[model samples]
Target: MTPEEWQAVLLSLRVAFFATLVSLPFGILVAMALARWRFPGRQILNGLVHLPLILPPVVTGYLLLLTFGRRGTVGQWLAELGIIFAFNWTGAVLAAAVMAFPLLVRAIRLSLEAVDPGLEAAAGTLGASPIWVFATVTLPMILPGIIAGAVLAFAKAMGEFGATITFVANIPGQTQTLPSAIYALLQVPGGEERAMRLVVIAIAVAMSALLLSEWVSRAIARRIAS
Candidate 1:
Protein backbone atom coordinates (compact mmCIF):
# COMPACT_ATOMS: atom_id res chain seq x y z
CA MET A 1 0.00 0.00 0.00
CA THR A 2 1.09 3.55 -0.72
CA PRO A 3 1.39 6.39 1.77
CA GLU A 4 -2.14 7.54 0.88
CA GLU A 5 -3.58 4.13 1.58
CA TRP A 6 -1.73 3.97 4.90
CA GLN A 7 -3.12 7.39 5.80
CA ALA A 8 -6.64 6.26 5.11
CA VAL A 9 -6.14 3.17 7.24
CA LEU A 10 -4.75 5.15 10.14
CA LEU A 11 -7.43 7.81 9.91
CA SER A 12 -10.16 5.20 9.86
CA LEU A 13 -8.77 3.63 13.01
CA ARG A 14 -8.51 7.00 14.68
CA VAL A 15 -12.03 7.98 13.75
CA ALA A 16 -13.53 4.65 14.72
CA PHE A 17 -11.69 4.60 18.04
CA PHE A 18 -12.92 8.04 18.94
CA ALA A 19 -16.42 7.40 17.75
CA THR A 20 -16.75 4.28 19.87
CA LEU A 21 -15.06 5.82 22.90
CA VAL A 22 -17.21 8.93 22.82
CA SER A 23 -20.45 7.05 22.40
CA LEU A 24 -19.83 4.31 24.96
CA PRO A 25 -21.18 6.24 27.93
CA PHE A 26 -24.30 7.29 26.16
CA GLY A 27 -24.81 3.79 24.84
CA ILE A 28 -24.53 2.31 28.31
CA LEU A 29 -26.96 4.85 29.76
CA VAL A 30 -29.49 4.36 27.03
CA ALA A 31 -29.15 0.62 27.30
CA MET A 32 -29.80 0.81 31.01
CA ALA A 33 -32.85 2.96 30.45
CA LEU A 34 -34.29 0.74 27.79
CA ALA A 35 -33.55 -2.42 29.71
CA ARG A 36 -34.67 -1.33 33.15
CA TRP A 37 -36.59 1.90 33.19
CA ARG A 38 -40.27 2.21 32.49
CA PHE A 39 -41.24 5.70 31.65
CA PRO A 40 -43.50 7.74 29.44
CA GLY A 41 -42.41 8.02 25.82
CA ARG A 42 -40.14 5.01 26.25
CA GLN A 43 -41.22 3.68 22.89
CA ILE A 44 -40.49 6.99 21.21
CA LEU A 45 -37.01 7.16 22.73
CA ASN A 46 -36.32 3.62 21.61
CA GLY A 47 -37.41 4.43 18.07
CA LEU A 48 -35.21 7.49 17.91
CA VAL A 49 -32.24 5.50 19.18
CA HIS A 50 -32.70 2.95 16.45
CA LEU A 51 -33.70 5.40 13.71
CA PRO A 52 -30.32 5.28 12.01
CA LEU A 53 -30.57 1.51 11.65
CA ILE A 54 -33.93 1.92 9.91
CA LEU A 55 -33.08 4.96 7.77
CA PRO A 56 -30.99 4.86 4.63
CA PRO A 57 -27.37 5.83 5.16
CA VAL A 58 -27.71 8.56 2.58
CA VAL A 59 -30.67 10.07 4.35
CA THR A 60 -28.86 9.92 7.67
CA GLY A 61 -25.88 11.66 6.11
CA TYR A 62 -28.06 14.27 4.50
CA LEU A 63 -29.82 14.88 7.78
CA LEU A 64 -26.48 15.33 9.50
CA LEU A 65 -25.46 17.79 6.81
CA LEU A 66 -28.66 19.75 7.25
CA THR A 67 -28.40 19.74 11.00
CA PHE A 68 -24.67 20.35 11.21
CA GLY A 69 -23.97 22.39 8.15
CA ARG A 70 -22.92 25.97 8.76
CA ARG A 71 -26.28 27.38 7.86
CA GLY A 72 -28.19 24.71 9.69
CA THR A 73 -30.26 25.46 12.78
CA VAL A 74 -27.95 23.73 15.25
CA GLY A 75 -24.89 24.21 13.09
CA GLN A 76 -25.25 27.98 13.06
CA TRP A 77 -25.25 28.13 16.80
CA LEU A 78 -22.41 25.63 17.14
CA ALA A 79 -20.37 27.60 14.59
CA GLU A 80 -20.47 30.66 16.82
CA LEU A 81 -19.02 28.48 19.54
CA GLY A 82 -16.03 27.67 17.30
CA ILE A 83 -17.05 24.04 16.85
CA ILE A 84 -17.58 22.80 13.33
CA PHE A 85 -18.41 19.39 11.85
CA ALA A 86 -19.73 19.63 8.32
CA PHE A 87 -17.15 18.66 5.68
CA ASN A 88 -14.52 18.02 8.31
CA TRP A 89 -13.02 14.92 9.94
CA THR A 90 -15.20 15.77 12.90
CA GLY A 91 -18.23 15.34 10.74
CA ALA A 92 -17.05 11.89 9.74
CA VAL A 93 -16.87 10.98 13.41
CA LEU A 94 -20.34 12.35 13.95
CA ALA A 95 -21.75 10.47 11.00
CA ALA A 96 -20.05 7.25 12.03
CA ALA A 97 -21.22 7.59 15.62
CA VAL A 98 -24.78 8.20 14.59
CA MET A 99 -24.80 5.23 12.26
CA ALA A 100 -23.11 2.94 14.79
CA PHE A 101 -25.07 4.03 17.83
CA PRO A 102 -28.02 1.76 17.28
CA LEU A 103 -25.85 -1.32 17.19
CA LEU A 104 -23.98 -0.21 20.27
CA VAL A 105 -27.18 0.45 22.18
CA ARG A 106 -28.72 -2.79 21.07
CA ALA A 107 -25.77 -4.89 22.16
CA ILE A 108 -25.53 -3.22 25.53
CA ARG A 109 -29.26 -3.45 26.09
CA LEU A 110 -29.23 -7.16 25.38
CA SER A 111 -26.47 -7.64 27.90
CA LEU A 112 -28.18 -5.49 30.48
CA GLU A 113 -31.41 -7.38 30.11
CA ALA A 114 -29.60 -10.67 30.56
CA VAL A 115 -28.22 -9.46 33.88
CA ASP A 116 -30.01 -10.75 37.00
CA PRO A 117 -32.06 -8.04 38.66
CA GLY A 118 -31.63 -9.99 41.89
CA LEU A 119 -27.93 -9.19 41.99
CA GLU A 120 -28.60 -5.48 41.66
CA ALA A 121 -31.31 -5.63 44.30
CA ALA A 122 -28.99 -7.49 46.65
CA ALA A 123 -26.38 -4.80 46.22
CA GLY A 124 -28.96 -2.16 47.00
CA THR A 125 -30.01 -4.05 50.07
CA LEU A 126 -26.41 -3.98 51.25
CA GLY A 127 -26.75 -0.18 51.36
CA ALA A 128 -24.94 0.58 48.15
CA SER A 129 -26.34 3.67 46.51
CA PRO A 130 -27.68 3.41 42.99
CA ILE A 131 -24.53 4.90 41.49
CA TRP A 132 -22.27 2.65 43.56
CA VAL A 133 -24.41 -0.34 42.82
CA PHE A 134 -24.08 0.23 39.13
CA ALA A 135 -20.40 1.01 39.25
CA THR A 136 -19.33 -1.83 41.49
CA VAL A 137 -22.01 -4.40 40.85
CA THR A 138 -23.87 -3.75 37.61
CA LEU A 139 -20.90 -2.51 35.64
CA PRO A 140 -18.57 -5.36 36.49
CA MET A 141 -21.12 -7.92 35.48
CA ILE A 142 -21.83 -6.12 32.23
CA LEU A 143 -18.23 -5.48 31.21
CA PRO A 144 -18.25 -8.12 28.54
CA GLY A 145 -21.39 -6.77 26.99
CA ILE A 146 -19.99 -3.26 27.02
CA ILE A 147 -16.86 -4.50 25.34
CA ALA A 148 -18.88 -6.34 22.74
CA GLY A 149 -21.07 -3.34 22.07
CA ALA A 150 -18.08 -1.02 21.74
CA VAL A 151 -16.32 -3.37 19.35
CA LEU A 152 -19.43 -3.64 17.21
CA ALA A 153 -19.66 0.16 17.14
CA PHE A 154 -15.99 0.46 16.25
CA ALA A 155 -16.34 -2.00 13.41
CA LYS A 156 -19.38 -0.16 12.11
CA ALA A 157 -17.47 3.10 12.22
CA MET A 158 -14.57 1.56 10.30
CA GLY A 159 -16.80 0.64 7.36
CA GLU A 160 -19.01 3.71 7.45
CA PHE A 161 -19.08 5.34 4.02
CA GLY A 162 -22.33 6.83 2.83
CA ALA A 163 -23.01 9.08 5.77
CA THR A 164 -19.35 9.89 6.23
CA ILE A 165 -18.82 10.93 2.63
CA THR A 166 -21.97 13.00 2.55
CA PHE A 167 -21.12 14.68 5.83
CA VAL A 168 -17.36 15.04 5.35
CA ALA A 169 -16.79 14.81 1.57
CA ASN A 170 -13.90 12.32 1.78
CA ILE A 171 -11.02 14.77 2.03
CA PRO A 172 -7.80 12.75 1.81
CA GLY A 173 -5.79 12.35 5.05
CA GLN A 174 -8.64 13.89 6.99
CA THR A 175 -12.06 12.44 6.46
CA GLN A 176 -10.88 9.90 3.89
CA THR A 177 -11.59 6.73 5.85
CA LEU A 178 -10.93 3.29 4.38
CA PRO A 179 -14.37 3.01 2.82
CA SER A 180 -14.25 6.51 1.41
CA ALA A 181 -10.77 5.91 0.06
CA ILE A 182 -11.86 2.72 -1.62
CA TYR A 183 -14.86 4.45 -3.17
CA ALA A 184 -12.70 7.31 -4.38
CA LEU A 185 -10.14 4.92 -5.81
CA LEU A 186 -12.79 2.91 -7.60
CA GLN A 187 -13.92 5.95 -9.53
CA VAL A 188 -10.58 6.42 -11.22
CA PRO A 189 -9.06 4.42 -14.10
CA GLY A 190 -6.91 1.43 -12.98
CA GLY A 191 -7.71 2.12 -9.32
CA GLU A 192 -8.85 -1.42 -8.72
CA GLU A 193 -5.60 -2.71 -7.24
CA ARG A 194 -5.47 -0.08 -4.53
CA ALA A 195 -9.17 -0.42 -3.92
CA MET A 196 -8.81 -4.15 -3.56
CA ARG A 197 -6.03 -3.72 -1.05
CA LEU A 198 -8.23 -1.50 1.04
CA VAL A 199 -11.14 -3.83 0.67
CA VAL A 200 -9.09 -6.69 2.08
CA ILE A 201 -7.88 -4.58 4.97
CA ALA A 202 -11.39 -3.39 5.80
CA ILE A 203 -12.76 -6.90 5.78
CA ALA A 204 -9.92 -8.09 7.99
CA VAL A 205 -10.45 -5.32 10.52
CA ALA A 206 -14.20 -5.86 10.67
CA MET A 207 -13.84 -9.60 11.02
CA SER A 208 -11.21 -9.34 13.70
CA ALA A 209 -13.38 -6.99 15.72
CA LEU A 210 -16.34 -9.31 15.45
CA LEU A 211 -14.36 -12.35 16.47
CA LEU A 212 -12.86 -10.54 19.40
CA SER A 213 -16.27 -9.38 20.55
CA GLU A 214 -17.70 -12.86 20.35
CA TRP A 215 -14.83 -14.40 22.22
CA VAL A 216 -14.97 -11.83 24.98
CA SER A 217 -18.72 -12.11 25.33
CA ARG A 218 -18.58 -15.89 25.56
CA ALA A 219 -15.67 -15.92 27.95
CA ILE A 220 -17.47 -13.57 30.27
CA ALA A 221 -20.62 -15.60 30.08
CA ARG A 222 -18.78 -18.76 31.00
CA ARG A 223 -17.05 -17.05 33.90
CA ILE A 224 -20.32 -15.73 35.29
CA ALA A 225 -21.99 -19.08 34.91
CA SER A 226 -19.19 -20.83 36.78
Candidate 2:
Protein backbone atom coordinates (compact mmCIF):
# COMPACT_ATOMS: atom_id res chain seq x y z
CA MET A 1 0.00 0.00 0.00
CA THR A 2 1.12 3.54 -0.57
CA PRO A 3 2.06 5.78 2.37
CA GLU A 4 -1.22 7.64 2.07
CA GLU A 5 -3.11 4.40 2.08
CA TRP A 6 -1.24 3.28 5.15
CA GLN A 7 -1.99 6.59 6.81
CA ALA A 8 -5.68 6.23 6.09
CA VAL A 9 -5.66 2.72 7.52
CA LEU A 10 -3.89 3.88 10.67
CA LEU A 11 -6.22 6.79 11.16
CA SER A 12 -9.18 4.49 10.64
CA LEU A 13 -7.88 2.15 13.30
CA ARG A 14 -7.40 5.04 15.67
CA VAL A 15 -10.91 6.37 15.09
CA ALA A 16 -12.56 2.96 15.39
CA PHE A 17 -10.60 2.13 18.54
CA PHE A 18 -11.58 5.33 20.28
CA ALA A 19 -15.14 5.08 19.07
CA THR A 20 -15.53 1.62 20.57
CA LEU A 21 -13.62 2.42 23.75
CA VAL A 22 -15.43 5.66 24.46
CA SER A 23 -18.92 4.25 23.98
CA LEU A 24 -18.39 0.96 25.83
CA PRO A 25 -19.37 2.06 29.31
CA PHE A 26 -22.50 3.76 28.09
CA GLY A 27 -23.40 0.72 26.01
CA ILE A 28 -23.10 -1.52 29.03
CA LEU A 29 -25.17 0.75 31.19
CA VAL A 30 -27.90 1.16 28.65
CA ALA A 31 -27.93 -2.53 27.87
CA MET A 32 -28.22 -3.41 31.51
CA ALA A 33 -31.02 -0.96 32.01
CA LEU A 34 -33.04 -2.23 29.09
CA ALA A 35 -32.43 -5.84 30.07
CA ARG A 36 -33.03 -5.65 33.81
CA TRP A 37 -35.11 -2.63 34.65
CA ARG A 38 -38.58 -1.35 33.98
CA PHE A 39 -39.05 2.37 33.92
CA PRO A 40 -41.01 5.14 32.31
CA GLY A 41 -39.69 6.34 28.95
CA ARG A 42 -37.69 3.15 28.65
CA GLN A 43 -39.06 2.64 25.19
CA ILE A 44 -38.23 6.20 24.32
CA LEU A 45 -34.71 5.73 25.50
CA ASN A 46 -34.41 2.52 23.53
CA GLY A 47 -35.78 4.16 20.43
CA LEU A 48 -33.36 7.03 20.76
CA VAL A 49 -30.47 4.66 21.25
CA HIS A 50 -31.36 2.73 18.14
CA LEU A 51 -32.40 5.72 16.09
CA PRO A 52 -29.17 5.81 14.16
CA LEU A 53 -29.80 2.31 12.89
CA ILE A 54 -33.24 3.30 11.69
CA LEU A 55 -32.35 6.66 10.18
CA PRO A 56 -30.67 7.09 6.84
CA PRO A 57 -26.93 7.48 7.18
CA VAL A 58 -27.05 10.87 5.56
CA VAL A 59 -29.76 12.01 7.90
CA THR A 60 -27.81 10.80 10.90
CA GLY A 61 -24.82 12.67 9.61
CA TYR A 62 -26.81 15.83 9.10
CA LEU A 63 -28.23 15.64 12.60
CA LEU A 64 -24.77 15.12 14.01
CA LEU A 65 -23.55 18.10 12.03
CA LEU A 66 -26.33 20.21 13.48
CA THR A 67 -25.51 19.08 16.99
CA PHE A 68 -21.75 18.91 16.87
CA GLY A 69 -20.84 21.46 14.26
CA ARG A 70 -18.65 24.27 15.60
CA ARG A 71 -21.50 26.75 15.62
CA GLY A 72 -24.05 24.32 16.98
CA THR A 73 -25.50 24.82 20.45
CA VAL A 74 -23.57 22.00 22.09
CA GLY A 75 -20.71 22.40 19.68
CA GLN A 76 -20.29 26.06 20.48
CA TRP A 77 -20.01 25.27 24.17
CA LEU A 78 -17.63 22.41 23.55
CA ALA A 79 -15.45 24.56 21.31
CA GLU A 80 -15.27 27.10 24.05
CA LEU A 81 -13.72 24.34 26.13
CA GLY A 82 -11.27 23.53 23.32
CA ILE A 83 -13.12 20.56 21.87
CA ILE A 84 -14.17 20.40 18.27
CA PHE A 85 -15.89 17.64 16.27
CA ALA A 86 -17.10 19.03 12.97
CA PHE A 87 -14.67 18.57 10.10
CA ASN A 88 -12.22 16.85 12.42
CA TRP A 89 -10.95 13.32 13.02
CA THR A 90 -12.85 13.39 16.31
CA GLY A 91 -15.96 13.90 14.24
CA ALA A 92 -15.18 10.70 12.44
CA VAL A 93 -14.89 8.94 15.75
CA LEU A 94 -18.18 10.37 16.91
CA ALA A 95 -19.89 9.42 13.70
CA ALA A 96 -18.57 5.91 13.92
CA ALA A 97 -19.66 5.61 17.52
CA VAL A 98 -23.16 6.77 16.76
CA MET A 99 -23.51 4.40 13.87
CA ALA A 100 -22.06 1.42 15.75
CA PHE A 101 -23.79 2.00 19.07
CA PRO A 102 -27.02 0.19 18.29
CA LEU A 103 -25.26 -3.03 17.43
CA LEU A 104 -23.17 -2.89 20.58
CA VAL A 105 -26.19 -2.24 22.74
CA ARG A 106 -28.18 -5.06 21.18
CA ALA A 107 -25.40 -7.60 21.70
CA ILE A 108 -24.85 -6.65 25.32
CA ARG A 109 -28.55 -6.45 26.02
CA LEU A 110 -29.09 -9.94 24.70
CA SER A 111 -26.35 -11.29 26.91
CA LEU A 112 -27.70 -9.49 29.93
CA GLU A 113 -31.17 -10.78 29.26
CA ALA A 114 -29.89 -14.31 29.07
CA VAL A 115 -28.17 -14.11 32.45
CA ASP A 116 -29.95 -15.74 35.38
CA PRO A 117 -31.15 -13.19 37.87
CA GLY A 118 -30.85 -15.85 40.53
CA LEU A 119 -27.09 -15.56 40.40
CA GLU A 120 -27.15 -11.83 40.98
CA ALA A 121 -29.72 -12.23 43.73
CA ALA A 122 -27.60 -14.87 45.42
CA ALA A 123 -24.63 -12.54 45.37
CA GLY A 124 -26.72 -9.76 46.78
CA THR A 125 -28.02 -11.96 49.59
CA LEU A 126 -24.45 -12.53 50.65
CA GLY A 127 -24.21 -8.82 51.55
CA ALA A 128 -22.82 -7.71 48.25
CA SER A 129 -23.75 -4.31 47.01
CA PRO A 130 -25.51 -4.03 43.66
CA ILE A 131 -22.28 -2.87 42.12
CA TRP A 132 -20.39 -5.70 43.74
CA VAL A 133 -22.94 -8.23 42.62
CA PHE A 134 -22.66 -6.96 39.09
CA ALA A 135 -18.88 -6.85 39.12
CA THR A 136 -18.32 -10.18 40.80
CA VAL A 137 -21.21 -12.25 39.56
CA THR A 138 -22.74 -10.69 36.49
CA LEU A 139 -19.92 -9.06 34.59
CA PRO A 140 -17.67 -12.10 34.40
CA MET A 141 -20.43 -14.19 32.94
CA ILE A 142 -21.29 -11.56 30.36
CA LEU A 143 -17.75 -10.65 29.39
CA PRO A 144 -17.71 -12.75 26.24
CA GLY A 145 -20.80 -10.95 25.01
CA ILE A 146 -19.21 -7.61 25.78
CA ILE A 147 -16.16 -8.60 23.76
CA ALA A 148 -18.37 -9.67 20.89
CA GLY A 149 -20.23 -6.40 21.05
CA ALA A 150 -17.04 -4.39 21.03
CA VAL A 151 -15.75 -6.35 18.08
CA LEU A 152 -18.98 -5.77 16.20
CA ALA A 153 -18.83 -2.09 16.95
CA PHE A 154 -15.21 -1.95 15.90
CA ALA A 155 -16.07 -3.55 12.59
CA LYS A 156 -18.92 -1.14 12.06
CA ALA A 157 -16.71 1.81 12.89
CA MET A 158 -14.05 0.56 10.51
CA GLY A 159 -16.51 0.67 7.64
CA GLU A 160 -18.43 3.83 8.53
CA PHE A 161 -18.30 6.30 5.63
CA GLY A 162 -21.47 8.22 4.97
CA ALA A 163 -21.99 9.76 8.37
CA THR A 164 -18.27 10.19 8.93
CA ILE A 165 -17.64 11.96 5.66
CA THR A 166 -20.72 14.07 6.11
CA PHE A 167 -19.62 15.21 9.54
CA VAL A 168 -15.86 15.36 9.03
CA ALA A 169 -15.38 15.53 5.26
CA ASN A 170 -12.69 13.62 3.36
CA ILE A 171 -9.53 15.32 4.49
CA PRO A 172 -6.52 13.12 3.81
CA GLY A 173 -4.35 12.35 6.88
CA GLN A 174 -6.89 14.04 9.09
CA THR A 175 -10.36 12.59 8.68
CA GLN A 176 -10.04 10.26 5.72
CA THR A 177 -10.67 6.76 7.04
CA LEU A 178 -10.44 3.50 5.13
CA PRO A 179 -13.94 3.74 3.70
CA SER A 180 -13.61 7.41 2.82
CA ALA A 181 -10.17 6.86 1.35
CA ILE A 182 -11.52 4.03 -0.70
CA TYR A 183 -14.35 6.24 -1.91
CA ALA A 184 -11.97 9.01 -2.78
CA LEU A 185 -9.73 6.59 -4.62
CA LEU A 186 -12.60 5.30 -6.70
CA GLN A 187 -13.47 8.78 -7.91
CA VAL A 188 -10.44 9.00 -10.23
CA PRO A 189 -8.75 6.96 -12.92
CA GLY A 190 -6.03 4.41 -12.01
CA GLY A 191 -7.34 4.37 -8.43
CA GLU A 192 -9.10 1.01 -8.49
CA GLU A 193 -5.93 -0.88 -7.53
CA ARG A 194 -5.34 1.27 -4.47
CA ALA A 195 -9.00 1.09 -3.54
CA MET A 196 -8.87 -2.70 -3.81
CA ARG A 197 -5.88 -2.74 -1.50
CA LEU A 198 -7.81 -0.73 1.06
CA VAL A 199 -10.75 -3.11 0.73
CA VAL A 200 -8.42 -5.98 1.56
CA ILE A 201 -7.05 -4.08 4.53
CA ALA A 202 -10.54 -3.42 5.82
CA ILE A 203 -11.50 -7.07 5.51
CA ALA A 204 -8.28 -8.18 7.19
CA VAL A 205 -8.68 -5.81 10.09
CA ALA A 206 -12.32 -6.72 10.64
CA MET A 207 -11.61 -10.43 10.46
CA SER A 208 -8.70 -10.07 12.84
CA ALA A 209 -10.89 -8.29 15.36
CA LEU A 210 -13.53 -11.05 15.12
CA LEU A 211 -10.95 -13.79 15.50
CA LEU A 212 -9.42 -12.06 18.51
CA SER A 213 -12.79 -11.62 20.09
CA GLU A 214 -13.57 -15.31 19.55
CA TRP A 215 -10.25 -16.39 21.01
CA VAL A 216 -10.71 -14.28 24.10
CA SER A 217 -14.29 -15.48 24.53
CA ARG A 218 -13.22 -19.10 24.28
CA ALA A 219 -10.47 -18.54 26.80
CA ILE A 220 -12.91 -16.94 29.20
CA ALA A 221 -15.39 -19.75 28.66
CA ARG A 222 -12.74 -22.33 29.41
CA ARG A 223 -11.71 -20.54 32.56
CA ILE A 224 -15.31 -20.31 33.71
CA ALA A 225 -15.93 -23.98 32.92
CA SER A 226 -12.82 -25.00 34.78
Please, what is the TM-score per model? 0.95, 0.98
Error of 2 at 35 (Å): 0.8
CA error at residue 191 for candidate 1, angstroms: 0.6
Model 2 lDDT-worst window of ten: 136-145
Candidate 1 per-residue lDDT over residues 90-171, each given as its tens digit: 8888999999999999988988988899998999999999999999998988898899889989999999988898888988
lDDT of 2 by residue, 52-170 (tens): 99899989998999999998889999999999999889999999999999999999999898899999999988999999999998898899899999999999999998899888899
Candidate 2 backbone clash number: 0
Query: Global lDDT of each model?
Result: 0.92, 0.94
